[model samples]
Target: MIDEPEPRRQTPQELRGLVGSANIPTLLMVIYQVTRDERWLRPPYLPTRSKGLGDHDSGGLPEPVQEEIRAAGVRALLDLQDGRAPAIALPDPEQTRRMLEACVGEPVDRSYGEMFAREFRRRAGADDGPARPVRGGSDLRVLVIGAGVSGIIAAHRLERMGVSYLVVDKHDAPGGNWLDNRYPGAGVDTPSHLYSFSFAPRDWTQHFELRGELERYFADTFDRIGARPRTRFGTEVVRAEFDEGRQLWDVELRDSDGLRESISVNAIVSAVGILNRPFVPALPGLELFGGPSFHSSEWNDDLDVTGKRVAVIGSGASAMQIVPAIAPSVRGLTVFQRTPPWVAPFEKFQQPIDPGARYLLRTFPLYRTWYWLKLYWQFGDKVLDALRKDPDWPHPERAVNARNDGHREFFTQYIRDELAGREDLFGKVVPDYPPFGKRILLDNGWYRALCRPNVELVNEAVTSVVEGGVVSSSGAVHEADVLVWATGFTASRFVSSLEIIGRDGQSLREAWDDDDARAYLGVTVPGFPNLFLLGGPNSFPGSGSFMHFMEVQMRYVGRLLTCMFDLDIRAIDVRKDVFDEYAELVDRTSATTVWTHPGTDTFFRNSRGRLVFVSPFRNVEYWTRAQSAGLEDYEIVAAP
Candidate 1:
C-alpha cells in the first residue's frame, strides 16, 4: 500500500464550500467513517435510493436536511484536520456494513461487508485494510506482456512480491486500448472515480474521461510506479513455449527495429489484454475505395475531415463516440449498424466534475474513499440481479427476467426521450436484443447526433464497400469521402498474435480452438505451467471496473508465486480436473444470462454462439473467489 501522507487538506472555508456541494449520502458516510459518529447513520441523515444511473448529489433529501448533514459533516471533517483530532480507524465489519447500507439507501448483504471494507481506498492513514503477506526472492523471473493497465498493475504487484520481472509492449508507451483507440470522443462508459487504480488516485476533471486524458493517466501511472526502468517499450512477444524439463518459458520477442531476442523466465503473464487486435471486416470491394479509410482504433490524427463526407461502419462504443464528435464538423456522416447496442443514460457524460465536488475529492481523503466506494457499488454487482435469467418469465424473447424487463423498459424510455421528435431514428438506434445482451454503451450525444440534418443512421448491415461509400444489404449505397470502421476488436480471441506452446506441444490456439477460449478463474491453464493469463477469457465482469478485476487477479497471482517460491516448486500447473470444473461452472452460469440469448450477435460469443468472453459470475463473487490462490488446485513440479 502507498504510505504517503493523507491527501492535502483544504482551507476551512474551502472545505465548507466543497462539503456544501458534495453528495449528502457520501458526506454522511465520510463523517461516520472519520469520527465514529452514529448520528450520521440515523433517520434524518440517511439517504434515499438514488435511482437510475445518476449520481444523485443531493441524495434526494430536502434542502434543509441536506444542509444540516453537510454542516455536521463539515464540522467533523474540520476537527479531523490539523492536530486537533486524529483520523479515526474504520469501524468493525458490521458497522461498516451498516454504513454502506445506509449510504446506498438499501441493504448490503452481510457477506460482502468484509470485502467492502477491504476495497475501501488504500490511501495513507486509512487503516481499513489487512497487511499483505509479502513473498518473493527465488529463482522466479517473470515476463509481463503489454504495458497497458493490467501490465502496469502486474509490474506493481510483482515488485511488492519482490519478484524479478520485465514488461514488454508493442507500443512505444503504455495505455493499451487507451493508447490504441484514439478515435474522436472515445472515453470511458464507467465513472472516472472507480475506473482508476486504487493506489494511484487522480483528481480527474470529468466523470467519464476521454481517451487523451485516460492515456495520459496510464503513461503517467507507468512512470509514477517506476515501471519504465523495468519495461521494454516497442517490443512484441512473438512466441512463448513451455520447457518441460526446465519448467521455464522460452520466450521470443521482436522489437520495433525488427531485432529479435530470446529469454527464459519462470512465469509469463499475458497482460496483452482482450482487446488488442483490431478486426477489419473482409468485404467486397473494400480495397477499391479511392478515398482515405481506417478503423476507429487506428484513427488518422492528421487526416482531418473538416467538411468531408464520412461513413462510420459500426454502431458500438467507438462509433457512438466518433459519430457525435465528427458530426458538427464533417460535411455529412453516415452510421451503419449490424445490430444496435443498449445505450444507458449517462448524465455526466463529457460533463466536467463541479469545482466544489472536485475540491471535496481532492482535499478530503475519507471523502474521496467513500465517494469512490459509492460509485463502485452503483456500477457493480447491484445491476447483476437484472441479468439473471428466470425460466418462468413469459417474455423471454425481450428480457431474461422480470428485473431484466424493467431494465429494458428503463433503457427503451431513455432512447425514446433522447429521440423524441426524431421518431425516424428510434427504429435505427434501438436494438432487438435483450438488455445486457451485449456491451451496453453510455449515451454521449450518440442519439442526439443521429437527429442532426447531416447525420444519417442506417440500420442495415454493410454488404460491401464501393469506390466512394458503403453498400448496405438493402442494396442502398451511402456515399462518403472517408470511412471509419468502428467494427470493434478480436476480443474473444484471447492473447492474439502470440503463439503459446504448452506441454505436450499443445498450442494455446489449439486448446481454445480459435475463439472458444476458457480459463480457470480467467487465469491459468492446465498444461501451461507458470503461464498466468491476466484479464483472461470469461473473467470479464459484465459490470464494474476492469481495473479492480485486474487488481484482484494480480494479487491472486502474487499468492501463487509466493507459494511456488516458499515451497521451492519448479512449476505449478493448474490441475486439469480443476480447470475443467471451473470451465463447466462458467458455461453453466452463462446459460442463465442474456449473453447466451439465441441469435443475438456479440463479441461476447464465439463461433458456436457460446458466451466465451464474459464471466458468468458477479463482480463480488469473482473478487471473493480470487482472494487467495491455493496450491492444491495445481500440479506442483519439484525443483531439481
Candidate 2:
C-alpha cells in the first residue's frame, strides 16, 4: 500500500495573523504589552520614524529584525490568548513614557504623556476600570437635546454616573446628520479606528465607514448605553427659559407632528451638533424650475438617477460624494463651484480590512489598543505644526509655510495625476488658495469623476435657477432634469433651532448677536446657568476625531457636575469675565493659524470674517483643560 498522504497542517491563528500587515512600531508595543518583554523596546527592535499613510510595515528595519518582531509578537499574543500570560499587560508610567518615545522615535512631553495615559485608562473600558457615580449625581436631572452623537455621548456619561437624564431629538432615532444625510457614498473622512469611542467600540468593516453603517453605529451605541428607553424621539426643544425662582429650565417641546409639550429640568446640555441645519440658497427662479429640486441633506433615496440629467450645485463635501456616486448612472451631470476645495489623498478610500488583520484586531486586546494609539498619533496632534502660519514666509497667497506649501504641491499634483490628459480641467479644479485654509476634502476619485466626458465642472457660483437649468453668475445655463443643493449648512447659526431665554429674559440669539456665538471653552455661556453646549463655538479642533472631542466635552460637563456637588451648588454659569477672556485668547491665537488665511473663504469664519467655529487650541491642550477648567470660572447658585 502507498504511504498515506500527510494531512496539511494548519498554522495557529495568532501566527496566521502575523503574516498580515501592521504598524511595526505599534506591533512592537503590542508585543511588549502582551509579553512584558524588554527586548521589544530596546535598540535592535526600535522603529525608524516614518511619515504619511504608508504602513512602514518593516519600520525601515532589516528583514531579519522584522521577522523576529513578528514571530515574537505572534508567540506573545498566543500566550495571552491561551491564558499563560496576563491578558492585558501595561508598562509603568516612566517605562510607558520611554516606550512612547522609543516607538515614535521622538521625545514626548510629560504633559502629553500623562494625558495619553489618562485617555488610555479612561476611554470606554479600554480595561477593567471602575465607573463610580459622581458624588450627588443621583439627585441631578439633565435634559439632553438632539440625540445625535453628541446627545448620545451625554446619555452614556449620565447613565454611568447614576444621573437621571432624558435625550430629545426631532428625528425618530439616535442619528443626527448621519440619519439626515443618506446621499450616495456618504461616509466619514476620518479613519475608522480613531473615529470611534475609546471604551471598547465594535470593530469596523471599513477604514472609513459610510452613512448606513455609521447610522447603525450611533443607534447601537445609544442602545448599548441604555439611552433609548430614556430618549423622547420625534421631539424638538423649541424653547428653554430659565426660571429664576425654581432655579431650573422650563423647556418647550414640539413633536414631529407640531404637537407641543413642556418640561423642566435641573440642567440642559445642547447636543445639537454644529452642522445640524441644511442651508438651501435662495437662488432666483428656483420656484420656476419644472424639475424636482432638493437640498443634499434631504436626499430622495427612492428617486432614480439613471439616464437622467442631474445638476449638483456647490462643489463641497456633499457634492463631492454625490457626484461620483451618481455620475456613472446619470446621463449628464453639471457641478457648479464657487471655489475649489483642497482635496487630500484618502489613503484607504473604499478599502476593506484584510481578513487576518481584522481577526487580530477583534481577538487581541493589546493589538486593538496599540492599533488605536498608532492611528491617534498618526492622525492627531501631528498635523497641527503644518497648520500653524509662518508670517515671515513668502508666497502666503499659495501656501502657509514650507510644510503647508508641500501639502498644496502634493494635492495639486494629485489633481494633475487624476486628470493627466485633460489639462483644460486643471484651472477649473486646482485651487489658488493655501491648503487647510478651507475644509480639506478627501480625493476618493472626485477628480477622476470630474474628468468623465459626461460630467461638466462649472467654475462659477449658482446665481439663479431657470425652468430647466441652473444659471451661473457668468449667465451660463447648465441645463438639467434634476437640481441638487449641496451648499452645506449655515454653520454660523449656533443653536438657532431653540429660542433660549437666559437670565433676565435675554434671548440667546441676542446674546450671540444673532450670528456670532461664543461660549466659555465652547461648552458654557456667561449668562446660561446649568446649561452646556456640545460642539459649540470654537470647540472643534478643525479636523480630528469628533467622537473623541464629544467625549471630552461631556467629561468636562461631568467635572462641572462634580464641582457643583462638592460646593453644594444648585446652578453654575460661566463667569462673564472668564468667557470674554477665553474669547479674546481664541481670537488672538486663531489670527496666527492657517485657518484664518484671508486667501480662502471658509465656513470656519462668520459673516464679519471672525473665526467663529474652529478651535485654535492643540488637542492635548483642549483635552487637559476639559478635565479641569475649574469651579472658579463659574458663578454658582447655592443648593436648597
Candidate 3:
C-alpha cells in the first residue's frame, strides 16, 4: 500500500486540474521526439505526472519505491528523448552500466541512440566538415512487395528521401487486408487516428471505421504521400532471392497479363504482413459440402445471407464482429465457439464520434492531443497496474492480483448489466475465464446481437463438414447453406507464405525450422543482407496498438538504412548472438504477462505453447529497443 499524506487533500477542482494538467507536455515531448510530429502536443491534459504515485497528493509511496518509480520514469523519458521506446523493468544503475556495454557493443556513457546517431552521421558524410557536393548518381532502387499499410509507408519514406521505389500488390488496388477482408462488420479495433501512419494524419469519419472507410483513408494517405504514382496494381511477387555475388535481390514478378518479368533491386522490404495466407482447417467431408463456404478473411460477395441459415466457425475477433453485423440480416445464425472471449464494456466502442468532438479534434489541435493522450493512457498505461502481482490475493486461480481481480469483477459486472432482465441468456453470454485471460474484446453490440431470437451461439468445435451443415464434437449438428470460417491466421509462423531464399540456398522457412522467427530488433536476420522486415516476430506488444509497434520499426529501419548509406556499406545483417539474446529476453518477459496464463490458450503462443505472437514487454520497452539499431547488433558489409 502507498503511504498516506497526513490526510491532507486538495479541492475537487484542484484535483481535477492536477489530473488535467499532469505532465501532458512531458508525454507530448516524448511522443514528439519519437514521431517528430508537432501535432501530438495539441492534447490538453498530460497523463505522465498522474501516472506516477509520487505526483498524487492523496498518497506517497515508500522512499525506495518512489525512487524506483522515478528511475523507471526517467529511463522511459530518456529513451523517448533519444528517439527510442522506454525500457521495461529498467535495471538499477549498476546493471544499467553492464547492459550499456551490450547495447553499444562497447562501454560508453552516452545512450544507445546517441552512439548510433553519432556513428551514422559520421559515415554519411553529414558530420562537421563543409559539404563537398559530390555528383549525384543513380537513385536508390527499392522494391516493396504488398501495397498495404507498411508498403505504403515504405513507399512514402522512399518518396520523401527522393529514392526511387516501386510498390507491387497482388490485389487489384491497395489496402491489403482492408481489400481482402470485406466480411460484414470488418473494421479496425484500434482508433483510426492512432492506427494511421504518424507521417500522414487524417480526420477519420467515424470512431469505428468500416472497411470501406479505412480503405479510403489508405487511398487518401497513399495519394498524399505521393505513392500512387509508383504503385504497380495487380502485380504479384512470385519469388525473391538474394544474389550473393551481386549483392542485390533478384525479384520474379507476375503482372496482370500473366507475363513474367524480373527486377533487380538494391534492397527489398517485405511488407507482406503475417496474415498473408488464409488457413483452412482440414475437416472430414469438407469437399462434400456443396453450399457456399469460405474463410472470413476471404468473404464471398456473390453469396447472399438475407434469408439463409449461416454457420460461422471460430470465435475469434473476426467471428465476434461478423456474427453481430450479419445477425440482423441472416434468417438464422449459428456461431461455433471453441473458447468464449472475455468482453470488456467500452462506452464508445460502437458509438460514433460526436460531431462537436470531431470538429474540435480536426479544427483544434489541443483537443486532438488531449483525446489521444486519454486513449494512450487508458489503452496503454492502466493495464500495467493490473499486471502487478498481489501477494495477499488468494484466488490465483482467477487472477494474479487484487488489481486483476478487480478488473475481472468490473468486467463481470458489465456482462451482468448487459444481460439484465434476461437471465436465460446470461448463461450463454457469460465467459468462464478471467478478464484478459483471452484477448479482451470491447462490447460492440455482441451481447445485443446474441440476444436476438434468430442467433444461436454454439460452444462446441466442428467435428466434420457434412453435405448440408457441420457436425459438432458433441454429436449435435447445425444446418446452414453458408459457412464462414472466422478461424484466425497462423500467427506464430511469421513470413510463412513468402518464398524467400537467402544465402547458400537457405530458405527462410528451413532457417527457423517453422517455429523460431527471430530477428535482430525484429528487423533484419543473419544471411539476409539488406532485407528488412517491418512487423516481424516478437515485435508485437500484446496490449497496445499495432501502429505504435509499426512506427518504432519504421523509424529503426529508416535509421539503419540511413546509416548504411552514410557509411558506404552495402549490407547489414543481425549477428546471430544478438538475435538469440533478444529473442531470449522476449521469451523471459512474456512469461509474466497474462498471455502466459496457464488457463488461457491464445494464438499468441505457438503450437509448442511458446509465447511467440504477442510480445510480452511494455510498449515503452519496445520503443527503447527499436529506436536505434546497435552496430554491434549487426554485421556490416561494404560494397564489393
C-alpha local distance difference test of each model: 0.83, 0.81, 0.66
Residue 64 in candidate 2, Cα distance off native in Å: 4.2
Ranking by TM-score: 1, 2, 3
Q: lDDT of candidate 1? A: 0.83
Per-model TM against the reference: 0.96, 0.94, 0.78
lDDT tens digits, residues 1-640, model 1? 2234446775767777877668888888877776776777888878898777778888888899998888877777787676454345665567667888899888888877777777763543364222343444534689999988899989888766667889999989898888778778888888988888876788799988988888888887888877899999999999999988888999999999999999999899889888878889999998999999898889877889999999999899899889889999999998888788998888898889887877678766778878877888888877877888899999989998987888889998989998877878787777777898888888888888989999988888898999989899999988999999889888888988789999989999999898889888999988889999989988878888888888888878878887778767778889999899888888899998888888488899888888878788888788877875488899886545
Top candidate on TM-score is: 1
**Where's the lowest-lDDT run of ten residues in candidate 2?**
1-10
RMSD of each: 2.3, 4.8, 11.0
Give the per-residue lDDT digits (tens) of candidate 2, residues 200-319.
Answer: 366688888898878878877888779999989999998999987789999999998999998999899999987968899887798999987999999888989899999999999999
Off by over 4 Å in 3: 1-138, 384-393, 421-425, 638-640
Residue-pair clashes per candidate, as listed?
0, 1, 9
Q: Compared with the true structure, what per-residue lDDT tens digits does model 3 show for residues 427-485?
A: 76666655677777776788888878998888789989999999999998789989998
